[model samples]
Every structure is written in C-alpha cells, then in structure tokens.
Target chain A: MTADFDAIVVGSGMSGGWAAKELAERGLKTLVIERGRHIEHGTDYTDFKAPWELPNLDAVPEREQVHYGGRVIAASTAHFRIKEDDHPYSVAEGKPFRWFRGYHLGGRSLMWARQSYRMSEMDFEANKKDGHGNDWPIRYADLAPWYDHVERFAGISGQAEGLPQLPDGQFQPPMELNCVEEIFRDRLHETFPTRRLTIGRCAHLTAPTAEQQALGRGPCQSRSLCSRGCSYGAYFSSLSATLPAARKTGNLTIVTDEIGHSVVYDVATGKASGVRVVDAITREHRVYTGRIIFLCASAIGSAHIMLNSRSERFPTGIANSSDMLGRNLMDHVSGLGAGGYMPGYTDQYYKGRRPNGFYIPRFRNVTEDADFVRGYGFQGGASRGDWRRGGGQAGIGAALKQDLRKPGGWSVWLAGFGEMLPNPDNRVTLHPTKVDKWGIPLLHIDCAYGKNDLKMARQANRDAVEMLQAAGFQGVNERKAEPDEPGRAIHEMGTVGMGRDPGTSVLNGFNQAHDVPNLFVTDGACMASTACQNPSLTYMAISARAAHYAAEFLKEGKI
Target chain B: MSISRYSGFSRRQLLSGGARIAGGIAVGGGLAACADSAGQEASDGLAARLDTLTTRDALRRPGHFFSIAQFRLLERISDLIMPETDTPGALAAGVPQLIDRMMVTWALPETRSDWLAGLAAIDARARREHGVAFARLEPDTQFDVLSRHDGEALSASDRAYRQMKSTIVEAYYCSEPGATEELRYDPVPGPYRGCVPFDEIGRTWAT
Candidate 1:
C-alpha cells in the first residue's frame, strides 16, 4: 500500500522531537502525532509571571491538587501538567506508583528538570557484568559521536569533568557553584579522594552561539523559572529546540490531540505499515500509513501502545515474538539523602539564581565493590534561607522583621539517584476490561525496587550524611530512604529494551524492533538498563542516532 | 495590572536590553565584568519597581473565604507576624488577601477549618486577657496574646496556629513588596557570582 508520509513519529516530546527533526531534515515527509493540546513555544510560556501576578499566588485549586497527591504545584507551570483524574492508570495490588505526566505539544519535555548527563561505558557494561538485565547491543564508543551531536545542538552548559563513571560531554561554560557548594566540593574531594563533585551539567545555554541565537535562543538569564518554560529558549526542550527545527525543514506535519492507538502490521512484509490513531477530543478513529514508524511515546505510553497492538501475524503484540515487550520496567531508586547547615560563611554570598546544582558522580561501584553491584549519584544545592523560614522560627513584629531582612545561615542538601536492576517482575500490562476516556485500554503498572536497589539507597543515605559531616557541616539531618515505589524518579525505562539477542529483548542495536525492520522505539522504552544519570539526554542521543540509521536504511531500501 | 491583560512586552524588552548590557560587560572585561555590570543594576531596579506596583494592586481585592470580621482579624494577625518597618508588612503586601483567596480556591476543607478555629482561639485569648475582641484590642495587647499562642503552637502540635502562621509567612514572603523590597528579589541575575562578599549583597535571595 502507498504510505501517507515517509515517516510517522508518535509522541512529540524529548525523543520524538529529535526523531522528527532528524527525519524531516533528511528530507522525509514526517508526521508528528501528539496526544495532547498544542502549545506554542514562547507565547505559551508563563515563566515571566511573578508570584504577585499569579492566581491564588500560584497554587493549584484544592480539588485538582489533591488528585495529583497534594504536592506543591507551582502556579507558573501548572498548566503544563496533567490532572490525575483526567488520565488514570492502575497500580498492581499493594504497589503504589506516582506517574507524573505532562501531556501537551512537548509532553514532559516542557516540565522536565533539564539536567543533562551522558551515560558512561561502565553503564553499558553493567547489565552484562552484573547479569541482571539483558546486555545492550551498542556500547558507549558507538554512542559517543551521537552524544556529541545532540549536546552541541542542544547547548549543554557544564564543566568538562574527567570522570569515567559520568563521561564529559560537549558543553558550554558551566554555571558557577555557590560559596557553600564550592566549600563542600573542595572539602569533600580532600576527605574522599574517589568521589568527585562538579557543577551539574544542564541543558541551558550559558553563552549561546550564533546558530542558537538565530534560532531565537539567548543565554540563560538565571531566573530559575525554567519549568514554566523559557521564553528566551535558553534551555533545551521540544518547544524551544527540536520541534521548531523540524518545522523549519518544511517536511514536518504536526497533528495534536491525536492519540496513537496501535501499530498496523503487514503480514506479507512482516513490517509495521502505519499507525491507528484516535482523536483525543473527537473520539474519531483514523489510520495513517507510513513507510517507517518511530514510537517515542514515553516508556509506559509506548509499552501500552505496543502491548495493545495485537495482530493476526503476531497475535500477542507487534514485535513481541519474544514476549519481552512490556517487561523489565525500571526507574532510578531515589528519595534518600541528607541535609544540614554550614556555618561561618556568613560573610560570603552569591548573585544570580542558578537553575542547576552540583552533581556528585557515582563512586560506589567504580573504585570499590560495595554490597550492591550498581551505584548512585547525588544531586543537590546549597542556599540560604529566605523569609519562608520565619514560619517555623520563633519571632513576630519588629524583631522578626529585622531578623528576616538579613540572610539566614547557609545550608547544603544532597539527594541520591540510584540505579535499579532491571527485573522482569517489574512490568507493565494492559488492563483487560478497563479503558480510558479515549477507549484505549488502561495501563496497569506493577514495579518495585529490588534488594540491590534498597541496599544502594541505604548506603546513599549514609554516604550523604557522612559526606556532609566530613565537609564541616553542622546539625546534619539524615533523611531515611522511603519504600521504593516505581516512577518517583520519572526516569522510567527498560521496557522494550535493546539487546544483542531478539529472544531477550524487543529492539536491537539501533532501537529497531528485531521483528519489524521499519519500526523503531527510541524513547526511554529502548533502554537496556537504568543508569544513575538522568536518562533524557541518552534518550535524545539514541533517538537522533536511530533516526539517522532509519533514514539511511530507507535510502538503501533495506526494510 | 490585571494578569490576564498584562502584555509583558515592556518587561521582556527591559530584560533583553539588560541582557545585552550584561553581554557587553562580559565582552569588555572577562571575569572583572562580574564585579561591575550596569545590566544588573538596570534589571534589579526594574524588577523591584514592577513588583511593588503589582503587589499594591493585588492587595486591593476583597476577601473571598473569610468573613469581613474574620478577614479583619486575619489582617491584624498577619501584620503582627510581619509588621511594617523599612519595607511593606504582610498586610501592606496583600498577604491576608492572598490567604483569603487561597482558602476559597486552594486550601482543603480541614485547612480552612483550622484557620477559622485558629482565629477563634486568638479571639478567645484576647477576651480572656483584656476583655475585648482580638481586632478591638490594643496593639501591645494583641502582640502579647499572639506571643503566648506562638509559644504554645511551637511546643504543642497546635494545628490551627501552625497552619495560620505558616500560611501568613508564605503569603507574605511570596508577595511582591515582601519578596522584592523586604528581601532580595533578582528576577534575572545573569551569570551566577558563586562566591561574593556578603557586604556586596546583604539579604537572602527571594526566588
């Protein structure tokens, strides 16, 4: 059958945006499908709105906030997030998961904390060495150039730290560490020779180049209101970067509010012919045929779509010949750290609201073998208390006013992101009877942290406390690690993971489904293992690499 | 200015202009530009002025959740926690109005009930000590009653008092005049000066 477009990229977010950009720039007519409302870049951003200008001082309505776990929702970017009631996913019995989702033109890219870091060679070899998950088909050497490609285009602001666990990337000048952070870094390095603390590598343009300036991006103004969306295009997001680049190619056609239902398979060709989509608002069904398809619809979202794509040739699911399609779900085991005050730096201060913090790269399994195989890294900042501290402090009237006018004592905190071993038991499946408002089957996520993850979390907490104490911090408060529920870190991965063998994984080296040559899943769903570093950057790099491969294969008529 | 009607053109222009000035400083002198950038001065002044104006306008809205008498009491309580000194206090910054609006729109029913109960407890204390409603009491008497409750609230798990006090503090600090003038509000500080003399910038950052 004749295809509607050359390529169809589902979910216009971090990965999908890159896929669309690469394909469209390669002169392929690309159709980008987003299952949410359209949101324009600069015009839609509310980052400039001050607290005084916000409705109810930037608090979400009670009923709405409660539905999303009663957490503090900043008023500036509340519009970007989805209310829990609107899109419901079930949790398996006794398993609690917090699925933070942002469904809009840019998906979670609009709301993602723009921490960008590359996974090291150690990460690629971890699963194989540890014998936990399937070994990745590709290695760091294969992805190095691709990481450089994405990093240069994205304008990552970070220092070139020579660390094997967390590789240095092509970066703009890194943001400066605050006084307390500098002190902690120096002292910690002296105290623990193995651990290294550097300023976090983030996707903010410290000094934008002419190319970035031409794209209407400017240097970050240090407002630290990035989640509200940067009007200056200082940070990397689909809206600020890839989608616009794709649009400029004139080969990109975006259809918002079009939910991808399933991938249509051709029995004769044994390739995915196209995708079936349901109108999010109109409930109308439409099938758009494409020569190639890329499922970048997030980890769980893509898994759900693939699991529901039952076919005559592959009755279980398309590209699920191994039955490993919706298994081995993983998120970074988090919520363990420590915080305390630093004294005697009252004379030193800092200017500018730094959007990024310091990153302590994983030292657990690097130099010395711990009880656990994998490791964790710490991400935190040091800052002085403002007037909000007055709430708990004892004072009122003139005295209280006088005290608050001056900055309070400086404090440092560290939160760990630990690697979770991929277990097939931690899986996602479609609910048999239940369906969403769009009539798509509901996703039932059943994932939990394993013994290794819990042990790592405990060590991370202890290390955090010890590090702070060793750095001459006082009144250290050790935060106990919480019971690991999946999806808290929002770095969910490993479903439909790429592996060397087709039997153990759904995708191969280039994020291509082993069963369907024309099909690609380049989002977090293609991760073979959950590396401690932020996964979005890896997702972008993989997506860009996969798109290039897919485009070349199309030219060679390989599929 | 009404947020819905705010064009945000002037602010954006001002910020971009400031950014250019900062950029010029960076080009003129590499690391030394951090010490003296006129761009920082321009942006800081503009942000402060805008914050003051916005906060002044926001404070004028009528209470939505609390009754007229209850709102009056809340205004007094808020002022006592953050009274006017060199800068605008909680009441002047429209913190009471923010709290009232939050109650109607954002606060849970239990939170709202706690606020009402806290107000009543204050009134009861005022009547017991000086035989008058909390709002009707003398300024010193009001302070004394609040001070006693503050101690009790800290020691005991006084949910009502804790809720009311925390809300007042949050609303005040988050307000424009309170955040900008009372503390240090730098909407755009350009490149972060990691370690600087505290004398250079005295107050804590109001992000």
Candidate 2:
C-alpha cells in the first residue's frame, strides 16, 4: 500500500532537518516524523532565563545529581534526563552506558556540541588506505560541496587556514581567544613544529550574515550558555535553522511523537512501501505510506528500526543480507586530559562570552610519530579561575565571603577526543526478553575497542599532561577517565555503514539501502567510519545531499 | 515523554542569574505540613529548614525558612560578594534562593556534623585563643580566622563540607546574575571586539 507523498523522513534531529529542508526546497511532498514532541523554533529556550526563573531553583534532585554529574563539579546541564522508567534499554549486568540523550523533535541537535568540522580525505580514505572495516562508498570530493552548502546556511564561525587534512568551509568571522589562550597557542607552536592550535570552529553566530538575517535570526548574544538551547537562533540546530527553511517551502508536513517502529518492506518490488510507527505518547500504532523512505533516527535508533523490519524475503532484518546491520559501532573515546594553574595571568581577564575554546585538531598517529592506524583531536581552553576557584579550601563568615569576591589564579584545561577504530566485534544486538514501553525490543549493546582505541586514548591523555607541564603550569596531571562504554559520548555512529561494495555493506554512496533502492538511511547509522571530529555536521551535509539526490532520482524515475 | 515543554528564557537571563539552585514548592497542599513543621522559625518571618538541610553552607540561614530579617542578612551577604560596581550584584540575581536550595542538599548528616562541630569549635577556639565568642569578635579577627591555616589538609568529611560551601558561594556569584549584573553580560553583542580598551566597556567579565 504505497502512499501519495514523494518521500518520508523519520526523526527531526540533525539529519532529519537536512532531509526535510532539501526535499521540500526541491518541491517534493515530504512527511517528516519526529519520535519526540514538536518544538516551536524560537519560542522554547529555557537557558535564556535567570536562575530564579527556573523551577526547583535550577537544582536537580540530590539522587539524580550524582548519577548525571560529569565529575567536573556537575556541569551535566539538566537536559540529560531521559526517563529511565518510561524508556528502558537492556545492558549486560555491571555495564552502564550513560546515554546522555534528549529524545526531542530535534533530538541531540537541541543539545549538540556545535563544534562543526568536515571529515577530510584522510578520514574517508583511511579505511581503504589501512585495509580496515570497509572503504567509504563516497569520498571527500563527493561531500565537499554539500559541506559547503550546509556550512553556508548554518553560518559556522571560523577562520579558514586551508589545510588538506582539515579542509576549510564557508565560515563567518571567528571568535577571538583570550590572552592566556593566545599565548599558549604561540608558545605551543614555537615549541613544536607539527602542533598547531586554533580557536574552536563553532556554530554560534559571530556575525549573522544577510542570509541568516533573512531567516529572522539575530546575531549571537554571547551569553555562552548555549547548552540550554539558543534563544537568539545563534547556534545551528534543526529547530533554529533547517526546519524553519523547510517550513517556508510550503511542502513540508511535520508529525511529531510518531516514533518510527519499522519500515514496511515490499519484497516483490524491492522497495519500502512506507513505515509503521507508534505514538510515543498515546501508544496508538499507525502506518505512513510514501514512495521513498529516509531513516534518520540516529545511529542506534535507526538500527533498531531496520533490525525490527522482518519480512518473508529478509527474516534476519530488512536489507540484512550482509549480516552487518548492527555492527562496528563507534563513538569518540573522550574525557581523557589534564590541566593546571598558569601562574602569570593573575592580573588579567576578558569580556563578553566566548562560547568556544581552542581546538587542537587531530595530531595523532598521522605521519611521523605513528603509534596507531587512526588519529584524534583536542578541544580545550584556558581561563582565569572564577569564584568557584576557592574549592578544596575551608572558608566561611564575612572574611570567607570577602576573599571569594576576588578572582583566583588562571588555569588551562585540555580535553581530547580520540578515534575508536571500527571493529565488527563492537556491536549492538536485540535483547531477547526485554522490551521498551512501546513494545520495541531493547537494544543490547556489546561494544568494546581493541588495542588501537586504548593506545590512542593513553597517548592523547599523556600528550595533554606533557603539554601543560611544558607550558609551565604546575600540578599538571592526567585525568584517569571512567572506562570506555557505548553511548557515553552520545555520538554513536556506524551501525550500518556506507560502502562502495554492496556485497559487504548495507547502504551505498547515496545512503540508499542496496537491497531496497527506495530505502535510504541518512543518519549516523550510515557512517562508514567515525572520524574524530563531531559527526553531526557531516550527518547534516550527507543527509541534505542524499535527500536532494533522492528527490531528483525520483523525478527522473531512476528508481 | 513530551509532557514537558521548555519555558522561554533568554541568554541574557542565563548570563545574569546563576543556574543549579534547588527549590521546593509546597504545591497542592500535600507539602504544607512538611513546610511548616520541617523548618526553624525565628522572630523574623524567614525560616531556616535545618532539619532537611544537608551541608555546611558558607551563607548560613542568616535565614531561609521564611525570616524576612534573616533573609535580608543573606541578601546583604550576597550583595557583598557581588557589589553594584558598574552593573548589579548577587542580590539582583536571586542568589539567596540559590543558597537556600544548595543548603537543602549540601547539609547532609556527615557534612552537618562538621558544620555544627566547626562553628562550636571556632567559637571555642576564639574563646580559648582570645577570650571572646567568634560572633562577638572584631571583623579583623574574623578575617584572620578565615585566612589562618587555609592550606591545611582537612579530613574527608571536612573537605566535602568545604567543597559544598565554596560551590554554593562561587556558583551563586559566578552565575549570570553574579557575572553579568555585578560585572557585565552582553549576550547579543553584535561583533566580538578582540582587544577593546578597558575604558570602552569598563567592567571585567565574571566568567
């Protein structure tokens, strides 16, 4: 029972927004389904409020605090609450995956770490170059145009210094580094020939272009409290950027809370008829029919749907001939780094909010000092110690209060994001007995890395500590991060990867399932390899490219 | 899952008011008894809910239950941390509420014991050292007390208590209100002027 619409896109997060915008802009009738509730773009940003304005005095319950705090004095901004009682996924006993996710219409885009970076030729060619899991079906040249397309509309604030491994994008004026960071950058570069540090290329609007102003977005307020959702439309989230553009095209129909349960596969035609979804709130099951389907419900989420789509022709799962539907999961192994007091900057401070920090982009086993097959990058910063700097001391009374008024010493902190090589052993499967609230089988994730991930993590941490000590910061030390587990970084990717060889992989160059031409998976599930950089930007570009291609293909009757 | 919708607040508010202060509301009459019975009642309308408090807050009930005068003392303490300078300060940012909620969780049994012990011992130390209770001591004496032996290694519980107090105070003032008001918070400052002269903007950034 094929429906009338030209295409259907599931999930409205990073990729979904791109799909919707691209399809609708091309005048295709597109139905966008979001598992979470709808969010009115400009209207709902709680971060813009004062502390007194929030309920519970901005306090998370004591019981809830210990579980959520990231151990850096509780900076796990409150949105990490995905009700454990309502939606439960099964894990092996003693294995805890702290999936810091918010299931909203915009998904993680609502709470994205908006450090936008394009995965260069080195990243795409890495798999084939090293004889790894699978070669990416597409390359940097194929995606460069789309990256430019997305970045231009998204308004990435950065300075382009045309390096091959780290390609430049359409960028706005970059945010400046503080005095301490500037000095650190110069010193580090002078000390080491290969090492280079630059201001983190972020999504916050430094200077909103005329294109942005036309979208009703104003310049960034620089309050730097962007994690709570940007009220100024300053950062690029689907709610703030893409969806709004899609809505203007007059061909986009959005249906929220319609969680895509499984795709309806037509064995005869080798095409997806539509999808079966259940109301995330009402528990009412419904079916949506469209000529083509684009699954963008995140990495693990899309895998769950694909694995659940059982048909007579494909019992293992829809398009699961390769038996690689839920394998090779990868998230950036993160939180291993160190920092210390920079004694000299006691008298200085900066003004306004610099939402981002210095990003020490991938300087790992790349060329000369080759330790591993893959690489990693560092996104960190230096700042003057604020009032909370008096921690680990006993102070009270008027005297204590008075001393607190003075700013403390300056300090530098560097946190690294290391690459986790894709391995078939690191996989997610369906838990037999457990079922979530919506009767969906719970995802049993059994993922772990090999020597490659470990070597990278250890090196990344040591380098940070050595760098700090070398920079003359006292008490320079390495943070022994909690053990690695899936969903920790929430940047889950590569469950059903894209590859040139359809004989070994599921999706193709255009993110279309090889077995089913009309079925497209444009989410993190389509990633062939998880590059060290944040994957959301790549997902957006790829989704837009695929959606635009799919619409054109449909118009040309290619499928 | 979608029952909750985010209330619209601005970056301006976030920069001006510190986040993460605990608050409890005796809504729907169920918690009315808990409210009145749990807290300490002073002559002033303000109340210090010690029974439920979990840690040693730097800014003690000076008061939190509902004593208007004691609450005023808290307001004054907050203001002192965040002086009017060019912008407003802690008092303008609702830091009293932030402290109140922090105290609720921070005043755990292990931590509270240290607080009661510390206060009693401090006064005793004052009496033994100089023959006067700490509260009655001169402002100079109090400053000396706070500064003395600040570098000493504290017991585990004592360290936790110290951490709580510093966190409460630091969090309150360092927040949007503490930084933006007491100093300055320009959320929508169109272009970032990297090396602006001090005289141009005047106040320093709190963060």
Chain B TM-score for the candidates in order: 0.67, 0.44
For model 2, residues A346-387, the per-residue Cα lDDT tens digits are: 556666667788887787755337578777788888765555
- Worst 10-residue lDDT window for candidate 2 chain A reads A67-76
Off by over 4 Å in 2: A1-4, A55-57, A63-80, A93-96, A394-406, A481-484, B1-98, B101-160, B171-190, B193-204
lDDT of 1 by residue, A299-407 (tens): 9989989998998877777899999988999999988899999988788888888899999999998975699889999999998877777777777888987887778
lDDT of 2 by residue, B1-207 (tens): 011111322334333332222222111212223232232222111213332222222232222332222233344334443434444344444555555444444333333334334334444455667776544557567546534523332334455336434544665555555555444445456555444444555444454
Task: Name the top lDDT candidate.
Answer: 1
Poorest lDDT segment (10 consecutive residues) of candidate 1 chain A:
A477-486
DockQ of each candidate, alpha-carbon based: 0.37, 0.18
**TM per model?**
0.91, 0.84
Q: Can you give the lDDT of residue A275 in candidate 2?
A: 88
- Model 2 score (lDDT): 0.70
